[model samples]
Target chain A: MKIIKNLALGVSFIMSTQLVSAASTGTTLETVSPEADRIALQNFYKKRFPNTELQDYVNGIYAVDADSRTQWEDIEAFPPYEFDVEEGERLFNIAFANGKGYADCFENGGIGIRQNFPYWNKEEGTVKTLEQEINECRESNGEKALKWGKGPIAQISAYMAWTSRGKVFDISIPDGDKKALAAYLDGKKFFYSKRGQLNLSCANCHVQGSNIRIRADLASPALGHTSHFPVFRSKWGELGTLHRRYKGCHQDSRSNPLDMQSETFRNLEFFQTYMSNGLVVNGPGSRK
Target chain B: MRKLTTSMCVTGLVALLATSPASALTVEESIAEGKAVYMGKSRGNCISCHQINDPDANLPGNQGPPMFAMAQRFPDKRILRAQVWDATKNNPISIMPPLGKHWILSEEDIDAVVEYIYQF
Candidate 1:
């Protein structure tokens, strides 16, 4: 079956230098069934690594590589992001210039709601991510917006994600709205489309080549990729938002990174987060 | 006489352009250069995704097919060159970087790597 998929991909590659749609593999996002896409993706991983529990994917590459898992376990024993989460909680409570706070901007006082983010805002006609909303919340409260990728923004998000740990993602798209579907499809196209001088799509590494070594590191699976964010990577020696990691991957592929919370990126978050619907949230995670 | 000279000049230019970078090196040097590019983490990094018959290859990956029997697998060296240049041309899902297409490796580097891999 892998051989067949490769052949189909080869044929599509011949058809165009860019925009090689998933149509060749019959997993095309042309259909309006996001549920089907989610199911198919889940099944793909289940078959690929039969021993991997669905919940385990939140660990990213650690789920597939036992040696890495051992190291990760040791790190988790004394989680480095504890200080970041504490700082975030402190910031979350501080009053804005208007005497209101971030709690005033969100339901449930903005706690334990990380999984439902990157949702379709029918009135706004865009996907709003947790990071974007955090900035928006600050701006609406007359506070200066935090930077999108790292620093305080990532710290705040880390606290929120920590509160929502073990809650499975439950993202949804409005069935009647063409705009919502269009946004999802746009993200789907972005995932499969080849870009940059490297001619790599997101799927080339994360989806098809998951668990594969690239030099010293492993290409993580797309499944549950959105679950863990606000990662405390040893490489950075600091916490950062999902968009920051996304930017790094783009740069590695020799492509220019898009602005954080850009429409394209939000849509991608929507698609990826929704695909991880049944997976548990496990963010503020540390990694090597 | 002028026409003959012009044709000869065109042929000479074509020959110069067609001459591969490897042609300038002794066989040993070309293979050594290719091996460096293949093993370098920042260069071809082929060993990151592929296994090779070479016992000296340190911790090669199994993500891609092993790089042995290349002389048999790709009978035409040009096909091997194209594959290295951009494996996606043959398999879009292939995670192999388009080393030449992306300018990740110079033409000279690719030519050398191709000569080295062709022997496998």
Candidate 2:
């Protein structure tokens, strides 16, 4: 591990030197590999919390703080999202006026398929998320679209997530596709770019300042951050989708929050979910 | 008529800008106000990532370096103020907010913060 760390550092140092020369000549910088980025990010958290297992990161803050873990475990004993899941199943099976349903829109009837989401759509030239697809499914089937963040959409998402428990995240950006790569790179840039009056980025809190407190709240590590979604937050007292959380985080930084399921956000989901490529599905989880 | 009025207003604004500092808070008052801003959760909240180095300080974080010997570390007060204004100018990856640059903290408040921290 130490040798790998040294090697990574050496490689980065060489790349940075090259980058400086490239900048001086007004040449474009080299494109980064998504796989390499994921490996490096996972290694970072592993080094940061030496005792933590990579898989344990799906638990978020609970993976580091024992007190929080205990509280989270007690809450998880009978998950708050149980009702939402049941409602989602009901909504999923119900036929639209056209006699088509969500199952008809997705492969394998949409069961246990949450792990394959935020995928690169070659024909559409866009990144597709399960939430966006759900709405698309509805609109195509002659039904009105559900709200993006909460309510029925969240419930259905929670149900799908519940079905996909333990399935590893397997997001993929199509090979040799420049547009897909561009989307991935854009998301990566946004993840690290500072914004808002606070002048903070997603990396600042989750990357550099994990486990640190901002007033009363502890910052969580970014690893496996996407594994859990459609979370039942005690603060909100209801279930909300991943985009909803992104919106809130942006607002907290005093940056203007992007619209739900927008291209920018869908691309961000692509980059973030790809980072947790090997983490198990553990969505519809509870959080404080 | 409009040009004369505009010039008069510009001159008046310049006079006010020049005299404002003289009429601002005194050294002791500035220091006190600076301390409040530094500690205020909605303001600087420097303690979120920095330790004040005071024994009585509460719940200081270890992300940034300890905040002792400010005068030694930053002999020139403007340099220190510039940091609080925007630390990223020195270190691009710095997590410190651009308080003045982003208008999160007014110039007057930043000056007060500089005065408060300079004592240590």
Candidate 2 on A38-128: residue-level lDDT in tens? 9978888887899999999999999987888998999999999889999999989999999989999998999999999989999999999
**Residue-level lDDT tens digits of model 1 in A193-238:** 7788777789878877788776567888899888989899999999
Worst 10 residues of 1 chain A by lDDT: A3-12
How close to the true structure is residue A75 of candidate 1, measured as C-alpha lDDT?
Answer: 94
lDDT by residue (B1-120, candidate 2, tens digit) is: 656655654564466445533427998999888888888889888877677865656786655666777766664455567777877665666677888888888888998887887788
Give per-model CA RMSD: 6.7, 9.5
How would the docking of model 1 be graded? acceptable
Model 1 root mean square deviation, Cα atoms: 6.7
What is model 1's DockQ versus the real complex? 0.26
Candidate 2 docking category?
Answer: incorrect
